[model samples]
Target: MKHILLIPENEKPTLTAAIINTLLVSVLLIALFWISLNQIQMTLDFSFIGTYRIRLIKGFGMTVALGLIGFIISFFIGLLSALGQSCKILAVRYFCNLYVMLIRGTPLIMQIYLFFYILGTAWGIENRFVAGILILSLFEGAYIAEILRAGIQALDPEQMEAARAVGFTRKQTVRFVLLPQLIVLTVPSLTGQFASIIKDSSLLSMIAVIELTQTIREITATNFKLFEGYLFLGFLYLCLTLPITLLSKRLERRFRHEA
Candidate 1:
């Protein structure tokens, strides 16, 4: 008896479809963009890239600074919250659950207003940048906590056992073994949440924070160039988020290959 099977070089069905779809999408996007280019009104001074670009450049720097500080604080707080949720101590887990629920369930703009207006007002600290950063950090912390929690749970119990057997304390095991793997697994999710924070930073427009979106609106209002100013702001936002989105994809690919 003879039986034969032939497999294509790209044997995976998903991969083949993915390749075809990607090519189609690229062609379609190029065609669309070429057509759209003719319609874009550039009545504003295109030569004004330097002067008009300054606010966005500075705004992007401030936005990046905001993301960095907020992500750092949020991730740190998330780590502790994840640990609390995972702790054997019942009260710790209960309180941590409450913290996550409270933050995740609330409307972020309201939280930002209240935190900055009510709480911050009481302290006489009405700094928009500081207020924006803290509110975002608090909001993002909940989401990051859940991401880290899931990452930790995805690990094999044996990995923790192995670390424990290697004469490592609980702290050392988590620091050396768990945290590294958790970070690798959660990078994509964290990047998305980071982007969310940047987009949400637009809400700070309520308080007149001079971030990109707010500044652009102000410029457009003054110049009566709504579309142009907003188009510029939209580009600035793409600049902020596109790199992270691409980086996240690259990270996912690297980890997939490693795994």
Candidate 2:
């Protein structure tokens, strides 16, 4: 014998504060969109946007690839610069410092222009893509060198002392004891630098590298959809950066757990 419980179909669920808040947010967003549309007085034509979808996709890929290649090259440059800065030779240290200072002091666009012109003149390298890689790597290398230097310096001096006590030479100590810890300490900073490099890659479009920003410019020039074009470009960049940011956070957490 089962007692049948009959629920009234006319009963309505009460709206929670969370649901009300979400509704309010949606309404606010709709209002903002209306305001923007009225102010701009332009039709929201996504047809133009779709026209350059392939180019945008290519540019997005190129931007990410360029950033990654630049990051790798800059890391090596930074590592070498860091090692050189810590060298016994005063001349090498001074040269490394000069390189860092020179790059840091100048504008990135100026660096790109100079690299393009000077490298073109001296080495017959006229490819803007190649030039962009070199420029970004060199620009980021200086900053990354400082980051690496700080990471290396942050370590307890006793570690190096213990390594030397165990018959490790100066080079061996750096290779084994110093480098592994340096890598862990510098990961967060390097991740930030990589993000910075991706943003900086947009400037390469000025040199006709046809990356994301260039694609945006090309699209907007066709339909005068400047706002939408830039908004889309910004979204594409966010798409590229957000993943790296999340991954960096995850890596930081994982490393912290391991430590």
Candidate 3:
């Protein structure tokens, strides 16, 4: 009798099998992590969480607020910059290109320090929160501009011709024909960028912004629960970003289906 394979090489896994395998891998990874922690004789005590819950909550709120405000401001900046890149005036196009290139090329930490300390002090911007929002917006706007520019460029040239043929004014064409498709194309990336904004907001802590990371740092400084504090910080960020990631995936699928 010929030996038979339990499953064919090219066969797709069943849902039950996939679930079982995922659970098995998860358990194995957890077990390995537990073993590594034991080997290092490190213990994580989260008992202080209850005592510092109010501060943590406040810090979490601050992070969310910064991300929301930064996203809104940066989105307009990006939109205008992207449009500027296509302008008839060479100066406008060059300025937008230089802005994107400078912001994108430099490290964000360096930009944060320079903006907050040098430009911010010279401009007499005393409030850390306001300065943090501006810095974050400036950094993330470069990335958003690139995303929007790519989406704009990806459209067929024939679409513009068709719109003009239909007697649509340039503004009307942009409002009706371009914006809708651009939104659909860029939604996934924009959602993902929001997740990035939340994480990047942590860097504002360096400038004494009282966001999530800064709060965790203060707690860790007093309590000396560095690992536990940062671990919980990661958990809190996951709470924010995981949903965004899921939403991005869902939108990508919907867009693909519509296409």
Candidate 4:
């Protein structure tokens, strides 16, 4: 007797439901916005966008720059720290573990303040941009270290053994085999972390770093347009993060396909 096989059907996306949800969300947002504005004695005023366009543009540029620089620095730190944690040497592993623990356990804002007030002063670096970038890099490095470590460790053990059996040096094996796969695995996560870094750049504003939030504050301080200023701030953050978020998803799909 022959057996019959059944395959599960894929669920089709419903555009009608999607459209209805989008419309519902739009209506709710509009109603909430109107109510909030009324409570705050504010009306929609997009005039600030035109008036401070150049300033806002500069602020956005600065914020992007901060995130990019910090991410780059953190990437290297994370890679090295991951390598350290994976090293056979117990001292190296312990030190790396301690570093990761110290950074991950603390609040990022506290780290930023400590860097600005304590380390920056000790280093005689009065530049807020440099301080902000350094602090963020340090803060993000711990998380990225764990991400990379997990990716490296999650790789099949046979790959490493095969490389060693072929008389490949550890360094050569990591460079030629491990790193390529690790990078593919970690790309989505790294991109998402970068997006978070962009958002966290707002915290630098508390220290008077002239990023997007700071720019909004400066504009609102003079104009008293709190509602308009904050709305634009949220919009600007979405602009910065949405592209990277989408890119991460795309990269994840591509990696999965390749795998």
Candidate 5:
């Protein structure tokens, strides 16, 4: 014999504070969107269009060049450092760790000022872009090293043992098996590193390198159009960052698919 129990067909759940807060946030965003569109329409003037376009194009190109070169240098430094830290030699590991720690501890902007302004042209290194790249490379190199190390270390110990067992020498294992695999796994981290390099390029403005942020600041100062300048800059930054974000997502998907 079984006892039958009857309950309400649809039980209503009580609204929590979190739910209320989410609704409030949605409403606030809707209102902010409406306000921003009105202001954007009023402020987006293309007066002095040719000059402004030239300034922006030149600045954007410089920014991209700096970021790309820095990414390459940083990636190289990071790989070497990551490998050195993971090396069997005690001296190699210790020195690599020390370098990583020192670089990570310092502020990137300070590094830029030190390299570009203090160590100027007469010191046989006057080019602002060159100094900017070196500093950015060193700054982001520390972080990218950690990412590479993690990606390498994330490989299974069994896989390494299997490589060794299969008559692969240590060097052969690293080159043929470990490095190729690490490069694939490190794609997301490298994308993040690239994005960081791009944003950090803004610090070059302090040394008057005329990157995108510097151009925007200069333009806003003359036009007294701070709001519009910032809005445009935000859009530019988004444009720069969004591709890296998509690439990272795509790489993640590919990795998952391969797995």
Candidate 6:
């Protein structure tokens, strides 16, 4: 008699199994959290949520607006910076390289202080909301630049050679051959970066940007419900980020399948 395997290799889990696992893990986490809270003799009170509902809604809107606007501006900045890095001109290449290095090396909080206090003061950027958006864009742009640069560099050299052999001009080659593939390759990563933008926008609260975090901070300050306020804050952020995270994974799988 031949030995038989019980399951197929690399088989995907059934929907029912996935659902069951999800519920089990969720229940385990909730139980552990409840037990920990009981040990600490602390109970969470979300009663303040109803009172501060309007402010929370406004703050949530501001955060979403900031993230959307920042991502758009930063994407263009990143694209140009990525292209500049590969340019033949030494000055452009060095400038782009230095930008990526400085931004990535330093903490964003420091940059925020430097830009808002010094640069914004000098330039007369009096509006804190505008200043925050610019700061977030510049900070995130460096990271996006590196992502795009990696995507560009990862493209197969043979494709370029093939384009040239087919008498495709540089512009034609880029537009027809390179741009489409680069977009496809980098999109999943870029989507994930948008989620990062949402989380990082919280840091803008330090500058009094009046986004979700700042709103929660102000509420907790008055009500002294720090635990409840922050717990709700985490839930609100999950509402924003979790969907993007799932979409990023789905895109990665779909693209990988296509390839």
Name the best candidate (by TM-score): 3
For model 4, residues 56-129, the per-residue Cα lDDT tens digits are 99999999899999999999899899999978999999999999999999988899888899889999989999
Over 39-127, each residue of candidate 1 has an lDDT whose tens digit, in order, gives 77334444444666778677677777777888899998898999899789999999999999999999988888888889889988778
Clashing pairs for predicted structure model 2, backbone only: none
Question: What TM-score would every model get versus the actual structure?
Answer: 0.79, 0.81, 0.92, 0.88, 0.79, 0.91
Question: What's model 2's lDDT at 187?
Answer: 93
The local lDDT score (0 to 100) that residue 139 gets in candidate 4 is 86
lDDT of 5 by residue, 34-95 (tens): 78878767545656436699999998998899899999999889889998998999999999
Q: Report lDDT (CA) for all predictions.
A: 0.80, 0.86, 0.93, 0.88, 0.83, 0.92
Model 2 Cα lDDT, one tens digit per residue, 1-259: 0112222367533445446656878899989987988997866666766777889889888999899999999999998999899999999999999999999999999998888887756998788899889889999999999999998888878888899999999899989988788778889778978988999999998789989899889878978888778878888889888888887887787777533
For every model shown, the clashing-pair count is 0, 0, 0, 0, 1, 0
Q: Candidate 4 clashing pairs?
A: none
Determine the backbone clash count of candidate 4.
Answer: 0
Arrange candidates by TM-score, highest first: which order?
A: 3, 6, 4, 2, 1, 5
- State the displacement of the C-alpha of residue 210, model 4, in Å, after optimal TM-score superposition: 1.2
Q: Ten residues in a row with the worst lDDT in model 6? A: 1-10
TM-score between candidate 2 and the true structure: 0.81
Which portions of model 3 miss their true places by more than 4 Å? Answer: 1-13, 166-171
At residue 52, what lDDT does model 2 achieve?
A: 78
Cα lDDT tens digits for candidate 3, 54-162:
9999999999999999999999999999999999999999999999999999989999999999999999998999999999999999999999999998887888889
| TM-score preference between candidates 3 and 4, better one | 3
For TM-score, candidate 4 versus 6, the one ahead is: 6
Which runs of model 2 end up more than 4 angstroms from their true locations? 1-34, 163-176, 256-259
Q: Which segments of candidate 6 are over 4 A away from where they belong? A: 1-9, 164-170
